[model samples]
Target chain A: MLSVHSVLPSLKANATSNNMTNKINHPELCQWLKSIAIDRDKQAFTQVFRFFAPKIQRIAQSKINSEALAAEVVQDTMSNVWRKAHLFDDSKGAATTWVYTIMRNVTFDLLRKMKANKEDNLSDDIWPLAELANTEEEVFTDHIQSRNLQGIIATLPENQQQVVKGFYFMEMSQEQLAVHLDLPLGTIKSRLRLALGKLKLKLGDPHD
Target chain B: MIKHHPKFELLQGFVDGDLPASLAAGIAIHNNMCASCQQKVSQLTEQVAEASFEQSFHHKIIVNDEENLTEIAEMDFDDMINQITASDDVEPTKAIYDERSIDFKGMQYTLPSALRNIELSKTAQIGKLSRARLNLGEGEIHTSLLHIGPGGSIPEHTHKGFELTLLLAGTFADAHGQYVAGDFIMLDKRDQHQPATEHGCLCYTVANDALHFTQGINKLLNPIGAFIY
Candidate 1:
């Protein structure tokens, strides 16, 4: 579904400024995104890259006013597009919207890092790509149905959400959670136990 | 049900990537809680994206009213593409639901997923009120997590710039009316109101300037306006 041009990549080198205004359309671009996600197709990634880079570059430079930083924004954003292509759900949004969201987030992170001189990036928390998974709006880093999460925490289908939280948000262990929460370890443990027991009851038998 | 929401302009700014991070994050949290706004946000995003890529949005700098349209670079595509595609490492996605909570004065309050990675200043207590600043680094524009204990009330005050209070949890009432969770209350310098919570509430607050305390005795306390904001 994702074909940037029937004219091929070599022809795109001579293609002028019209690249940004190129009518790749919605479903067609989404086909490229889907190809990249399912097959790790490099050519599809290249097509997507050609379509987005100039637009991202223009927007980034306009926002930051630095050529190098703007290039960094495009590179990082496109790299993320390649690496996390699987997260895009065509059902939830258009490919343009997805790329726009990513590009904007890259701008936010780069701007804050340069201006505030802080380490933590705020985009992940604010945009929260994965939080949409449990709901119907799952897109932009949606993961439950995407991959085997055994690398992080093995969880029950019912407990899937609780464990899923650990992946996207800041990593906080039970001890650190206790420290931040200002609760005794025993209290936290018992509270969890009680909550889980109640949840089990509310959900019907453990497996059912 | 969420009664008040961020104005359409703010939502547009959010989709346009023009808002301060603090304000944008506030809308995101609200969007998560309110289904109506969420739909609006997605629609806005689509419109913005279509304009950004397909239209003459490239011919204009949308930020300031500058005539500076950055010329798009026609750099080496093959090199950049080859470099990026070298990595076949498809990161195994470890993601699903988010349920991040914060601890305030020995009470565990669930935080909006938007605040999950935000850094908060230490809790500062004043009377029955407590606040933790969200360090978004937008100077002169302060954003905070304010907790009003049961029966506690904010002194009667008017805003000097603008104030946005998004009820994340619990309930609070002002001169206008009662606010439940998911309510977004935005007040400007012209508005004057006093807010108090009977059952207590935690609010995500944003203000560009200090407040102007009205009414009698609280006049001298106006200097602490910066603190309350």
Candidate 2:
């Protein structure tokens, strides 16, 4: 969910494109976010909300079936943004990827339900807007921390790596993995267990 | 002090968001009390989000109006400049927060429908497990199929309601012992049994209720019980 407050602290009043830039550079962007989420600072949160809302809206407009629904989704995404900001790891991804992922998950969940009903009541026109690939130069590099994970996975034995990949990236079930590898179901389960234990040991303590 | 769950793979499915709704529901019930698994889920979810972010996502523009679209299109050209300047000027620490709550009750409805239609099939001789879902109006029902390799078996457990097992091929043994192809076993709430395929069994199981795990780490999956029904 995107909040106009997040995208614009002074919408229409000091709303020049330049002022928006200054707003982005505000040295406190991350700290302000921390305050709002960790400290529950309302004013700081409101600023963050305005600055990011437009982007969030742009996101929802692209995915949901209707503008109204898109607006709702953006709103939901933003709220989660507020609540989960503390959960965000800057080392892992940029603010954009973080926000967009929330939007995507919420949209995917919505689409799944609508698809289930098999209802075609909503026309595509009513949707806010679809995502545009060529419009911006947002690179996926913002979230490159995953390369570290891949690196960690690479250190595992080929069999363990395949097990993790098949389950996580390929979205295979344990039963499916067992059948595909021609291993006993128990063996499949044991390999996955061993793989995770190794990951936990290798990856820094998750709690920290 | 974390106990190793026998169904870690199942929990992996939960963290990765791929478990069938019924199975997920069963796991959810367990997650509430299991801090270790809960922490594991949180860490894994973060990994997923991070992985997704690494893959370049080109937001597809689906809007049709040329004029408004063009305006946003032009806005994109200047977006990086705006972002750069904003980053440079803003202390970022002072950024304010938004207060309104965004409701996402809509996404919850999709969970059930998504799990309703997966086909159980595999190239291996062991066969596959498939759930043939039937929309019964009041609620949904489905028959779960299990094709055991020779000597394969579904572990024993209890059902919340009535469970009927119809042997389709090979043979299986439950707490009550053995059954051949064409044999039918009906279990009620009071029934508790471990089923093993002696020569690897193939059976169609119609469970009207969820499994109530009485022992073992399978109980960790109880939180995700909603999807099973």
Candidate 3:
């Protein structure tokens, strides 16, 4: 068993002093979190929170317009992190994915409550991909796979490709797409559904 | 012909971490049983990972934080684990009710102070056969564990987001059928059904979002259904 002092050698170094933008998973940091999380280590939690709080803030701000609301969402999400630390099983899901899922849920809840009756607008920046930890090894693997997917998507018809981008990258609702193109709601849904099905086929997704 | 699940696209959204909570929870419940959907989810997950790895669009979210709250949290996680692993025969909390004891079919369900006036009490559960309550998003979601005795039932209902029920003891049957101890049942907005305990049951349910009662006729009778979620 590593002593707290021995494991926390870089604790002070990792603390936010000058607003340093560090990678999500600094090896020493992840190790410290794993130790604290399993053992309910407080020092480790503080270090991890200070580092990730900004990222949470960023997600909330970029997605939701209100800074105060975004801050509240971050605080709520952080409190959840504290409470559910024991539930984290590394084998099932990554820490990054788990946190993003929480943020996504919170954001969705807020948006849903605020805009219960209003139609969703697609032109706005609605769909932003959640962040994941990236390592050097993952980068190499991704380069090859992305090149393949990019090539496949390029082969799709212009209309299908546009809808895919509009839905996936832009996060437009089917209604929004319909309104944007002056098409029937059914047409937009069918088009996006068919386009995705074909893309999955070309990508050789198992379901296809 | 196996009609492709409507959730194929929804699962894709979930894998990509883009779907709304209600939709994602619905898809998750379905995915728990469908291997085909799981495969598609895995594929989408791979694509997402690849897209993220090449050049992550934004900063990553870290779920675990071992900081200021650690002092109170340093208490053994094993306590929870033990509670989870312990047999139902060994009762940890009280079944006896003094003033707080709820009498339903001769079984006592002790109400915690936080939930004393909440009206989700044992009697209320039994009296109303088919009812639903929208919790109005109150209380600490997972802390209070609810126990439903044998033959006890909660009327047909749907959730706004996600509902996780880990059966600690006994059995319960819903529209989807029966579930026993050690069986973790998840439900979402898309699902609507009643759950009834058989041979007595103890369950820990964690609900995110609200509960919607589909039996519209019952809603008119129980105006204060504000509590039964």
Alpha-carbon shift of residue B208 in model 1 (angstroms): 1.9
Model 2, B28-59: lDDT tens per residue?
A: 43343334444444445545443332211111
State the lDDT of candidate 3 residue by residue for A1-208, as single tens digits.
1111121232333333332432345354446547655666666666656645655665565467566777666665555555555544454545655555556556665665565432232101222122122211222233424444545666777666656654554344566556545678888778777887777666445334
What TM-scores result for chain A when each predicted structure is judged separately against the true chain A? 0.54, 0.44, 0.48
Q: Which candidate should be chosen as best, given TM-score against the real structure?
A: 1
- RMSD of model 1, in Å? 17.9
Error of 2 at B169 (Å): 35
| Better candidate by lDDT, 1 or 3 | 1
For model 2 the local lDDT of residue B156 reads 49
List DockQ for all candidates.
0.15, 0.05, 0.05
Task: Show the lowest summed lDDT stretch of 10 residues, model 3 chain B.
Answer: B55-64
Largest DockQ belongs to which candidate? 1
Candidate 1 — which residues are off by over 4 angstroms?
A1-22, A131-208, B55-67, B70-72, B96-99
Give the CAPRI class of candidate 3.
incorrect
